[model samples]
Target: MIPLTEEQQMLQAMVRRMAREKLKPRAAEIDNTGEFPWDIVELFRENGLFGIHFPEEYGGSGGGVVDLCLAVEEVAQGCSDAAVILAGQALGSKLILLSGSEEQKRKYLPRIASGEFIPAFALTEPGAGSDNVSMQSRAVRDGDYYVINGRKIFITHADVADIFTLFAKTDPEKKARGISAFIINKGTPGLGIGKIEKKMAHKGNHACEVILEDVRVPRENLVGAEGEGFMEAMKILTTSRPVTAARAVGLAQVALDEAVAYAKTRVQFGQPIAKFQGIQFMLADMAIKVEAARQLVYNAAFLADRDYKSKEAQRASSMAKCFATDTAMQVTCDAVQVFGGYGYMREYPVERLMREAKVTQIVEGTNQVQRVVIARALLED
Candidate 1:
């Protein structure tokens, strides 16, 4: 096991307690009903869980990326969707912390920190998924504002975000280099929410389409320079990937816990299934994978917290995200097997966990893309 500081240990204990007491009971209900858990979000806000990773000068808790990962892991142990609400808060504000001008930080970070606002990252469009360069969103500069026109699909929290860190091409001739980031407020003219996706898992969270039509944004709202959005987005992803891995680790650990508990009480062959060597072996492997994935998640968070720029850090983050999420999928499926017929039923939490695990492999860039990133980084080294 990786050693944690006293503060981290304390944070973990507090969050774990909160997860068990507050989040665990609601997780299955949230999944079954497919309702947004506003009360849970309010609880996070009331407890100062929103902006743990931002600087204190901007109304944050003054913690780093690792702090966010730690908190996320604990919350995810109960509800992956609840954990995502916290993750989305970080995702929205990270670009501001990384590359926003001082004015932007002063204007926006405080609201996010105070949980008075929810932010969304708007980059993916109808034509762009992994190939961000294929994005068709356009932003033409006027005298004092840029008129943005296009739509962003699969945007997290699109229906309720108070602000958006949006990407659009200001100069399309330069391809990726021409992309610029902007802070678009929620009520801007011609900006509206479109379809809400009915997803298979993480039902408490919604990903939707953000439609922007001749949306006028002041030039002062731009984040970084006019041509740095691509690099800024890359930086955000590298750090976010570790947190994503932390989510997977927490979910995997929960699956293992459920499997072990079921195995001990479940009768098979006239005795407890856990007494059998085969069942014991499966549980053992699940435990091993969970621990290994946890270690990698923490290691990646460490590199990210220190702002390490080495190729090793890049590779570690991708490795953790890929390995942990893949483990989540495998471990959850194995957990379902341990429950046998009961596992396949919706009454049991394992079935819900299994469905939730599949999304981790696809989100924060697919596991396939993560491997490509690791390989490219290795080649660079």
Candidate 2:
């Protein structure tokens, strides 16, 4: 295992304890009710988890991507739903950290770090999931403001977010290069929340549609220059992939742990099922996958913290995201197999782990997309 610094180790232990004592107990109820866990968010705020990756100048802890991944992985081990909330904050603010003007950063980052303002990343649209350039959202500059008109789908925390880092096409003819990023406050005149999706997993952290019809944002809210949003978005994804991979690692680890505990206690043929060779092999394989994924995730995170824009970091991030999430899906399924009929029941946490693992493969750019990125990076001159 890669060694963590004393501070990182302490942060991990504290988050693990909090997850175990607070989040895990409520994970089931959150899943059942599909309600956002406001109390858990409060816990994260009090623990300073939200600011782990932000700079100390912005009211953060002056940590790096590795610190964020450590916290995310630990929280996910107990409750993947709650972990999503913690990670989503980082996702929403990342673009600003990468490209926001000093004035913008000074104004917004501290509020996010303090958890006084919840933020959402608005990029995906009904028609533009992986092919972001195809988004129909348009932003027209009018006087001192940009009038944004578009519908963003699959937006995390949209309904509850106080602000959004939104992207729209300033010049549709240029395709990807035409997109511009903006920050829109929640109560802006034409900004409205649309459908809230009932997801198969991570139900406690909501994803919904954000409708913008002539939402006027000031010129000062524009992030970076015009036509830089796509590049900025890609950069943030490269940096965030490792964190996503860490989440997959945590979910798989918990699933493996649950399976092992069950096998040792579950009786069959007048002996514990763990004594069987078949179960033993499955456990071994799960452990192997989880460890390998963890190493890859840490490697990517280290590279990202060093320099996110480097080609090496980009390739490693994609590779880690793809492999770790795939491992999570496979390991969780095997865990269910170990549980047999009990795994299929809602009472078993393995069932939920299995469900949650599937989303890790799908989100943060699907595994298929990650593979494309890896291949492209390999061929780059």
Candidate 3:
């Protein structure tokens, strides 16, 4: 383990304790009910986890990206969905801290960090998922305010968020360059929520679609300059990807732990199944992949938080996200296999964990997109 400061070490221990005590035991209930785990979110907020990646002045603990990533891994070790819920606060706060000005910081960050305000960064649209620049949302200047129209799909916390950090285009012809970020209140007129999506995983994170039909936004609500949204979003993703990667590592580790523990007790051929060469090899691979993924996640997180001189930080972030999520899928699947026919039963938690593992490879830019990002970075340099 990397040596941490006294406070950092304490924070890690606290997260592990909370995860085991609070999140792990309730994972089944959350999955079965498919409701937002507001209680768990409240626990995180009370624990000062909401503003983890921001400065202390903003009601945060002054922790950086890597510290927050460590926190995410611990939370996910118990429940991946809860970890993702925690990520909404971390990721949303990161976007504003990176792109918003001092005034915006003072106005928004503190409330968010304190959990007085729940923030949502709305970017993805039904048509614009991987290609974020293709966003059709428009922000038309109307005197002192800009009227925003169009919709965003698959936005985390769209239905329940108090504030939405939104993306829209001021100049359609400029495409990506024209895109600008804005902060719109949830109660604003003409802003509405569409259907809440029922997803295969992360049901507790509560993803939904947001509709802004001529929604009025003050000039002051603009996050950064027009034509800067794409870059701003990229900046957030470059750092946030590692958090997702870390969460994936946590999921893989849990799967491995569950599999190993089961293998030690379950009987097969009059011996523990763990004695078999096949089971041993599977466990070995699971352990290796999880540790490797953790390293990549930490490396990327370190570079982002420390503002490292390494030129490859973005690529490292993409690599970590891609590799770690892939490991989650493979390891979770193998974990189920290790359980034999019993793994398929509802009595086992591996099935739920396996379902949760599939999404990590798809979100925060798909693994295929990560390869493209890695290639583009390498070629550009």
Q: Local distance difference test, per candidate?
A: 0.89, 0.93, 0.87
Ordered from best to worst TM-score, the candidate numbers read 2, 1, 3
The lDDT, on a scale of 0 to 1, for candidate 2 is 0.93
Show where candidate 3 strays beyond 4 Å.
308-311
Q: Clashing residue pairs, candidate 1?
A: none
Question: Across residues 184-295, which tens digit of lDDT does each residue of candidate 1 receive?
Answer: 9999999999999999899878899999999999999989999888777877787898888889999999999999999999997899999999989999999999999999
TM-score of each: 0.98, 0.99, 0.97
Between 1 and 2, whose lDDT is larger?
2
What is the Cα-based TM-score of model 2?
0.99
After superposition, the stretches of candidate 1 with alpha carbons farther than 4 Å from their true spots are: none
What's the lDDT for candidate 1? 0.89
Q: Write the per-residue lDDT of candidate 2 for residues 92-197, one digit (tens) a residue.
A: 9999988999999999999999898999999999999988889999999999999999999999999999999999999999888999999999999999999999
Candidate 2 — which residues are off by over 4 angstroms? none
What value of lDDT does candidate 3 attain over all alpha carbons?
0.87
Better of 2 and 3 by TM-score: 2
